[model samples]
Target: MAKYLPPLFTRLYLSLLTAIFASILLTFYLSEQFLQRSDVVDFYEDSLQVFIDVSSYLQRNGQTAEQLFKDDTVLDPEFEILWQKNWDANADCEHCKFLSVIANTAIYQLSDEQLLAVYPLQQSEEVILISDKPANSSIFSGDRRQQNSSLITLFRNDPSEFIPYLLLLIVIISLGTTLYFSVRRLQKQINQLVKVNQEFGRGELSARAQKNYTEPVNELAQSFNRMADAITETVSENQIFAQAVPHEMRTPLSRIQLATGLLRQRKLKCEELVLLDNIDDYIDDIEKLTRQVLTFSKLNSISNQCDHQAKQCIKLDDFLQGRIKRLVVDNNLSINLNLQALQLECDPAYLRLIFDNLIKNALQYAATHIEVNLKVSPKNLIMLTVDDDGPGIDNLQFETIFQPFSRLDKSRNQETGGLGLGLPIAKAATRRINGHLFVSHSHLGGARFSCQLPLKVP
Candidate 1:
């Protein structure tokens, strides 16, 4: 039964209801306690007032009854008068008995029937009975010798008693009803979210989570729909990317196969040898193209799956130095390095690609020198800049230069025969590492490519 129920809404509803009921019950109990206490205090004060009025009258008549009310040490008291003065002196006195009778008489002056337990002034041990009228017509009647001397008690438990309780019940029911509707509304919203999430998981990219017309759930629904639209667009792009792969590979593979057949015959001329070199270059480009696709796919796939892991940290200076050394030694491009000691959390292979493509493109255009600079900022940003001394890009075309298959010419003429995916590939790789890449005018009189990547602190 517990497993069948969804936990979040269940827990939320239970908690809210519990709090509401608890507050209602606690308030009811506390209010009742306060009312009862206040009633008791008010009754006690009335009894004290009656005692004072009667004692003042008796004192004016030279009766010793007034001496029975004051205590030495206590600041405020209600029952001290009941045992004040000598015990034996007023035990059998007629005057003391009369005084008790008069004190009890004063109680009937109030609205409610009041009971009194009075003691004598001279002998604090004797009981006194006082009333406004004779004993047969008295509303104030109680045993004066009763052990509990707090005799004046009034109770009013009419409609007022049940009114507050009814109000409390109403409050509880209101809260429970409110919580029930709220949970139902919340469950509906969650169902929409869950349905959309399930569709997404099943690769239904166009599916959306629709929401109620009257709530913020509508905004959330819109957001989910937007995300689904983006996912659908991305899926379409990837499908196109995957479909184009075979067509893109056919040209190079056909050339390599044909060139190999010709080479095997041993009848290849000097011109044919150059064609073989061209075939090898095509093979290399194809291989690199396949690697770029795989790299891009892996980066996108794993980015959503993994958190930042320190094991992925690459020492910035060492990693860049190694790549720079390889490019210089193997490609023989005049390259200079100015790198700093910085660590970065990233896949080292992908990071290498960003630099490799940038440098490779620079070498293709550079006339004399290629410069690489790496700097670590106090704000924990790793900045890498690569520049070349060649024909700089036209100011108007800088933004369009990074688009796939975009170049000075649409056909990408023999002088610049690349597919024009290098800058875009580099940009994608930079995004994978939560980095930014851009192009600007270079100090080397050519184009400069700069990347800002987050750093890993030791």
Candidate 2:
């Protein structure tokens, strides 16, 4: 599951999750601390203001503080006064501590049972307002004390707080979800374009991307389609030229061969006989080049047109045995075969292009020994390898070696280095049959040409 998702997707998933939850938690905490209902705020502020006003009034009027039952003159007061006492000014309470002092009013450290406040009057007396906490109060403090202390309780008492919190949460979640799905859709479209490109690479020149995509992707598809169009036009014209020239030259080539054969039968000097032999060799090389180009042209134009039955399974071991025996008899080279009995679905043309060139090269370059291995892989692939103890190729030349007319062996006389289309033909035909061919350092102290083909054709 971890490997299936792209690295960008995994990183975005974690980052978005952390951002959403962390933003929500930070917003909720800030709202609980600073943004709150008006009445809840007024409760604590009014306590200090009311006490200060009364204390000033008592000093001006020469009267004592009002008692709850005895103060019938006061009506609808904000605080239900439980008790008031004359305390020593500038003296701390024995059991409780001073929380803060504002405008000569000292806020006491409240107890769970009572709300306590102290104020100094005339620098001689401390008037303390103490009341038993009401069970059915309008608010509950965060500290569980009887005083109103927190804004979180606003959610239970007011819809305004909860509504904003819920809306913020919903908006955060919705944005993250939208971004996630947007990227996922983009990745899906990119994957589809990649698949189309693979099909075109496999010789399905008609494969193209559809226009049902979002921007950037749509523009990229258009660019690829334009490039494919130009390449297809160029390749079609070149294929026609390649096929026509070789075919038209065949008539002249045949005439030359026939004239040389007749001239050899007649009485001629020794130099004239050598010239005829040279003409025969030149005709053969041209014929070989024409055949190579024609074979490659046919393979290059493959468009998946083979019928289902054309891809037939054959006994691979038997197929190689016959071909290897014939090649050995013709070349007179000592070659070893390690074959496994396996069935593989293959096109005969592609098989010919692959083994004919591979075995031929081994015979040409090998000093004295050659080996071939044919076996089934654990991945259900048919593996074929040909090894030779010749001057092995350098690693730097591996890529260029598969290109047409590429000969790494520079000092070849007429007997060696046949037209250098063999490796390119083998490589192209490997693609035609949906296989991979690669070169490795051989165990026999030379070059190894390995081909891996799927057991079932796609």
Candidate 3:
């Protein structure tokens, strides 16, 4: 669970829980106060009932004592005297008293017992006082004291009065502090990680993040590291191989090249010269092989070099005719050209290589005709198609035909001479120039290889 949640989310969850705990505490405090004060409300009601009983007793009529009470002579001829005598007796009788007094002598004067207050009501001129005197004559001071002290005790202990609000304030402050610190810590780690990433991107390969990555980023970094390590190791191995391979092949190739040159210059008899010609042919094949190996090595070293080189716009119809003319003169091969005067933007050397491989493949298998076609579209695309009347490839082998060292022809004889990297190298060169190459069935009942090149305007 801890790992599933980010630290920020975890902190937020804790903050919410803290807030809930505080709220619950505050609610409990209020509820407890309400329960405590319930008894005080009942005490107030009892005081009201005692006052009603005293009022009823004062209204009673009797003999001389009643007449004297009515005349206010024996009652000290003042309402205060009557009220005090009865109020004090009731306080003592009931043994509970909860009252206070506030008086003004200019108005009705107060006696010994503390007068709570006398305030005029809004609609009437009559003033009423709720004093620290018992309402009933029968209730004693001891009885009143019990109820009075209980009310004061309840007010003191009731949590609803202030504690709930105090607790809420503390909880808000604490949660805010916790959130602030957690955000600051997370921000610091994130900023540090970003800085490290920027340094690494700028070729500081040794740089690393302080905090562990958030899953996706970690996996991405791991993949990049793996790829970088593989490239580094492979480059080191290639450098070693490049140094050794040329030295090993150089001795044999130098001898073959020397023998071919000598044979070309010497004069001899017919049969003897024929033997020399055969030797010369074998030497030429060796030279070609050596050259192919060197070219392959260079291609491997810089696969994208073609894209960086300058390009020229060449006419397809004129170019094909020239190429076919050259091939017929050099290799004694017959050719037929079928193309439009379409212009293409490409590196001439690479484009020549593409057509050379396709034409050579055709010449090897073609019975009579090697058909070439060039198509153009308004969308800046040029398609070159080469077809031959030869044994076609199976659909299952189509994808494998483009692999290096892959050849459908089983025989490895001089008659069908090739290093098998021709087509693959052509494909790589085409890709470097952002071209597409694919093979399909031809009209001549053989394989048709088509290459599409984007013809951008100079």
Candidate 4:
């Protein structure tokens, strides 16, 4: 389950989203604190102004403090005036304070409580002003201890109070969506690079990463493309060199064969004849090696052109009969055939190469007889099986034999004339025609080379 977790981009996006929300919450908290402090200061300043205005009105109107205090409806909506005939030096309320002798007025500011102002009037009477909404007596009644408790209650009760949280949520969603797409875009590019790497690893030398993107990934892609180009060029050069050397050596090898043939025609001693035969054998080996190298080179070169090659609809039985007839006459081996008249669309040239190598390998190794079987499978695949009566190969050597220059211990003997490339060439030719080839222990007492070619080559 853990293995199926989200990839790197998703994890990074989640981490970034977490950080964004955390920062937003911290900013909201600090802003709320600052605004609350400013509200407190503004409340006290407004309360002081109200007290001064009420005192000035009493002095100018020539109205007695008792007349102003008695008429509650005549007072301003936000201010309330209270008259105390005797000023109490010791009050139960800790917020009450005495005025100075010179000014005879003092303001008391209580933490998390309402602001209070006391003004001494003539006749030893005192006027008190409290900073709170006149409609709510709970402000100074000690029921609400917090300065903004009512506002806080209103905020909690209102449905629109989630606006800030909602806005923050919207911002987070927008950011996450944008980051998701950006990361997906990057992931797509990285996937392309990975696919190209996989193709190159699978032996498609032309595979390359795309370099048309922004920044770091693009730079890496460009570097990868450059490296692929260099490797491809080097491999092409090596293949060309390999092909050229064999072609060059073939001409000299033919000359050697011609010279040995001429010597064989002349009269020679038994020992000389034997030495000449050995020379002929060596020449034959070199010629075979040359041919195999050229065939391998051609197979490699043809891979890129397989898509462009025209395929023909050919009768499988007729083709196999002709090829088998030639093999029987050339190798003087008894070959049995069990073929169905199946029609297949493929390159005949590639089929011929594949069959020629497999049959030749069987002819060289088989003790007595070779059996060929051809049929059309239910899946519309043309299955071909070539079996021989000889010592079968080890199961471990199945894949090894399909590799270039890979020979079994027994086949390494000089007399076999096996250059260890027959199966490799056959395998390459099989792939060129979109076919599969494998070997197993045959019922005929030797190795069976089974090939399955798609009926319709594409």
* Top-scoring candidate (lDDT): 4
**TM-scores, all models, native as reference:** 0.48, 0.77, 0.48, 0.62
Q: Which parts of model 1 are misplaced by more than 4 Å?
A: 1-216, 219-223, 226-230, 233-259, 266-284, 297-302, 306-311, 329-334, 409-417, 456-458
Whole-model lDDT, model 4: 0.77
After superposing all C-alphas onto the true structure, candidate 1 shows an RMSD in angstroms of 14.7
Which candidate do you rate higher for lDDT, 1 or 3? 1
Order of quality (TM-score): 2, 4, 3, 1
> TM-score of predicted model 1?
0.48
Q: Residue 294 lDDT in model 4?
A: 88
lDDT of 3: 0.60
Sort every candidate by lDDT, greatest first. 4, 2, 1, 3
Model 4 CA deviation exceeding 4 Å by range: 1-157, 198-207, 261-266, 329-343, 367-383, 409-417, 443-445
Best by TM-score, which number? Answer: 2
Q: What tens digits encode model 2's per-residue C-alpha lDDT throughout 81-144?
A: 4333566424434444445555656555445333445544454553545333455551223344
Candidate 3: regions farther than 4 A off: 1-216, 239-248, 256-279, 303-306, 329-336, 377-380
Q: Which structure is stronger by lDDT: 1 or 2?
A: 2
